[model samples]
Target: MSLTREDVAGIARYARIALSDDELTEMTAYLNDAVALLEPIREYDLEGVEPTFHPIGSLVNVMAADDAAADERALPLGIALENAPSRVGRSFRVPSILGDEGGAR
Candidate 1:
């Protein structure tokens, strides 16, 4: 389905995007081309083919094993708080979000 300028404009408005006349024209052509490319796939016969999650067979877990015994070095607290600008007794001190009386505004 070829998209008109009005269709592209409506899509832009719905998406909260500002498009110039040239941009609208370009987008209309681009959308029409994309629809034309997808037309063949949409009309293809897949009567007996089963739906698959992955296109190329089952996927293998590529992540590293979560074994705690693999590493033993613990992170030091001083090193972690070294970059903090404002700290009070081993904790970060941030500006109070409440009012001067420490009550919710």
Candidate 2:
């Protein structure tokens, strides 16, 4: 299926993104390329091939007897914070990335 400018606009609106004219043009090209790339897959022969939902086989967990267990020792919160290079009070302090630092975007 071909992608139209209206489709691109609707996607941007749903994503809450405000795309400029240049960005819209780029997105249109990208969407077209993506659709074109799928054309080859549509032409592949699959009459005898079994459909696989996963490339790697699905994991089947073996049933095990459930038993009430004793409590286990856990690491202290203070020790966890100590491992971090930066911390404020009891929380880990990550570097600011908002426009204040022009990095969030």
Candidate 3:
């Protein structure tokens, strides 16, 4: 489908954006050109192809192997928290925001 000047103008009005006549005309043509670029994808014949969540079907969870090695090389908790400006228990303590009453929100 193609877009017209009226369609662009209506969208701008709904979005509460004020555009000059030149801007409106220029944007309408610009959007139409963008749409034209994607038009060729409609010609693809994929009736028998199965839809996939990802483009690469062979992708695997590489993180599972890394998790084992990560546990062996992990830094001790005491050393990791040594340079922290402030901390509470096992986590970093950041200043309260939005005028929080005090402790954890």
Candidate 4:
């Protein structure tokens, strides 16, 4: 089913999208074409065919244990802070944008 201007406006309002006239025209054509394409899929015969859950041939992924540490000999805080352009008592210093020029209130 081809979408009308009123249909597009209603859809946009439901989706909270503020579409312009040009954008609405493009979206209308796109939505109508999508509807046209899906109409043929509904006509497909799937009475005996089993439903396919996965389009790609792959097994369900099981995550590995998080106990394994990826990196050995992690750098110390002092060593890491040495590379920074600025520093506080024990942390890196950064420019402030609010009430005070200082950080962490």
Which predicted model would earn the best lDDT?
Answer: 3
Q: In every candidate, how many clashes are there?
A: 0, 0, 0, 0
Candidate 3, residues 1-105, lDDT tens digits: the string is 677889999999999998899999999999999988887888999899888898899998665454655686677888888899998899877877656776564
Q: What is the C-alpha RMSD of each candidate to the true structure, in Å?
A: 8.9, 8.1, 9.0, 9.3
Per-candidate Cα lDDT values, in order, are 0.82, 0.80, 0.85, 0.84
Candidate 4 deviates by what RMSD?
9.3
Candidate 2: list runs displaced more than 4 Å. 47-50, 61-105
TM-score of model number 1: 0.44
Better model by lDDT, 1 or 4? Answer: 4
Q: After superposition, how far is residue 1 of candidate 3 from its true place, in Å?
A: 5.9
| Arranged by lDDT, best first | 3, 4, 1, 2
Best by TM-score: 2
**Reference-based TM-score of each model:** 0.44, 0.47, 0.41, 0.44
Per-residue lDDT of model 2, residues 8-98, tens digit only: 9999999999999999989988999988988988898878988777677776657645543432444577987878987888898776656
TM-score-based ranking? 2, 4, 1, 3
- lDDT of the structure predicted as candidate 1: 0.82
- Minimum summed lDDT over a 10-residue window in model 4 is located at 64-73
Stretches of candidate 4 above 4 Å error?
Answer: 13-16, 64-105
The lDDT of model 4 is 0.84
